[model samples]
Target: MLVALLLLVLALSNEVRVNGERGGRQCGANPSLKPRPHSVSILEFGAVGDGKTLNTLAFQNAIFYLKSFADKGGAQLYVPPGTWLTQSFNLTSHLTLFLEKGAVIIGSQDSHHWDVVDPLPSYGRGLEVPGGRYQSLINGYKLQDVVITGNNGTIDGMGLTWWESFRSHSLNYSRPHLVEFVASNDVVVSNLTFLNAPAYNIHPVYCSNVHIHNISIFAPPESPYTVGIVPDSSDNVCIEDCTIATGYDAIALKSGWDEYGIAYGRPTENVHIRRVHLQASYGSTLAFGSDMSGGISNVVVEDAHLYNSKGGIEFRTTRGRGGYMKEIIISDVEMKNIDTAISATGYCGSHPDDKFDPNALPLLDHFILQDMIGTNITIAGSFAGLQESPFTNICLSNITLSVNYASSTTWNCSNVFGFSDSVFPKPCSDLDNPSNYSSSYLSMLSMKGKTMVSGSVSMKK
Candidate 1:
């Protein structure tokens, strides 16, 4: 059962009546309902119950009323503007929130308003506090064919208070996700601005056929944000023409590594992120890792612009994770003032342990980086031999990098092949020693008179 159903039952049991609206009634109270019936509109249950202003309790009542159709077919929730203050809303299948211009859905400042029963499978073991732990402003469940769009209005979390509290708290403190889609399908969020979020801005977890377009997410620069959009181990997710200004990775995919085992080794693949503009994030502009317990592959990013970002185009993995990242193509990437233009790091370092075995570990292979242009890449290229693994089957071609800050790129050459146009790693003896490597691996690197040295650039294969 969804938490929305629980909230509705609680609301009905309390007999919290507002105006002529009754519990267990449709928008107009017709029991003989059919698929694709007349579209019902909700506008009479705000602060004034007259559709003029925001009645917080009235709006909450309306939300509970909307949950009755969670298991039904198609419906629409219409909001014609004014400030609608309420707790979290659970979206149903075949449902859409069509906001007329000048509309705003503001979440309550108090956390208790969002308190609802847990909706997980287990009671007290697999998750914390069961279904009550999962909460969001607009939560869509395993439904299909849903759209949440607004022309010029905003979906404000009113999360300034939550942000302040999170910053004041410790790193172990967990916060609620703002807008989440769990196991849902065919969802689209377009032409809206999500501002001042409590946690991750927009998350589509364990979902497929998801599209998020033309969204503008803005949070304070000082906020210790985690991610703007997290496509967590979900497939067929597309994010395009979005502007993100935050304190963390613009987009990331996370799956609990040691926490979630190999039985659930599915990765976030078949993802396309294009035409995204990111500015001033604490993490990477477009990245994978951090939560690589599930693995990621077949991801493509094109026509992206980054400004003053901490990092750019990161691929990372750690020891406890059993996932692999492969067949990633990043092209037409332009950047300025980024922490690094390209970086790949492993959680298992140069020392081999139980977690570092090429035979059983995930492979990073068939990566293509083309038509990349950047200025002042801050970090040096990562060709260092880790205790666990080194890069394999990678290609970087047609790259034009200009370093206005420094001279020469860096390379350790112990594991990478086909590296050209280089400046540093003076002797390049790591490539000369064949016994330390496979037969033809060291013969594939060429780094002479390609471009002037800045930080460093290396291509691994």
Candidate 2:
């Protein structure tokens, strides 16, 4: 009996190790690429954490050393407990930037000191304006096996200046994010607290095999355009167990903008988002597009909670933005105090310019929402497709939502085709009757937990 117990313990340990390595493997990182035995604190590079001194050069010199050490098995740059004031700094590959508890990295308020990068090829211009974009507080490019984790350390972007400039239409370029990884692969960002980003909090663009978990992100509800996490034109990404309270969408997926995006066709695919708590002051909990002309597919959002958000699950695209969005699955969601429980519109936001082709209509199909519950919602569901190209093959089952007493409780659907079963507020006539659904249709709906995209992808749960 004792021998059997020992064997069982060994088996359990092996299982835990395997599970932990799954993320590392997906990110192209392995134990063999571990950081060198040497660890250096920022103080060693003459960094002063008095919260007033400029530490940009110190950070730069330290990262330069680590970059040179990349061939020497990499290195770890440690940020000790204090407020470190610095401008944007580039990160090196095969390195770890670990922040101790109580450590804070504060972005410098001087805008002129920030670095500027060219606009994205897919956007043809900055997303907000028509010029270059300011680099993020912690920016990386074309890196591999990079990890940013800490004991819930804070990275604060002093964005009030940028916000004022935007509201007053005095900005020449787009604001910077709190953290951004561009053209990077095998990245992991976890256990950090992000606050007051000028634009998006976390953005990973043109990257693949990224993992983000156990992070808390926040910004003032009144702050404009402060999105939480945006994965753009990337693949094989996973985001789990995070809390996001921001001004815009808690999590927005994107590929590219209008005509420029169609020319540079790189789609965002195979993303998994689970166990997320989303709160938005002015936007949706989970959103896609408003700028997705490069296409987005095979996304699974499950086990999410939303509070005081404008929309719960939303998809937005306009006539001039041509993209295909399909195979999206949302399951086991609970929402409270939301304006709209579900929304899909093809004419929500405006185009970048009149030069865009009006014939570039979006295509949407194979959307499924299941096992959802909502309370104090303004509208149970509002789905509006384009008159020229209607949405198709939407499915909803096992949904129960309560409309606010002061609001009309109804499901408004137009220019879409789909079916519903055991759904509240009764779906529109475009959907087939629940009783008339075939057994195969029922079986497909029942397979919600097994596969999010018809055997293409499986989530870790």
TM-score of each: 0.73, 0.89
Q: Could you tell me how far off, in angstroms, the CA of residue 361 lies in candidate 1 after the best superposition?
A: 4.7
| Model 2: lDDT to the true structure | 0.81
Q: Write the per-residue lDDT of candidate 1 for residues 318-427, one digit (tens) a residue.
A: 55455677666566778888766667766532211234334335445445565667777665345433355555645554566555455355433444433222222222
Which stretches of candidate 1 lie above 4 Å from their native place? 1-41, 47-73, 116-134, 170-173, 348-362, 383-385, 406-461
| Per-residue lDDT of 99 in model 2 | 86
Q: In terms of TM-score, which candidate is strongest?
A: 2
Clashes of each: 25, 0
User: Model 1 TM-score?
Assistant: 0.73
Superposed model 2: Cα runs more than 4 Å off? 1-36, 433-461
- Cα lDDT, model 1, residue 278: 85
The superposed Cα distance between candidate 2 and the true structure at residue 108, in angstroms, equals 1.2
**lDDT value, candidate 1, whole model:** 0.58
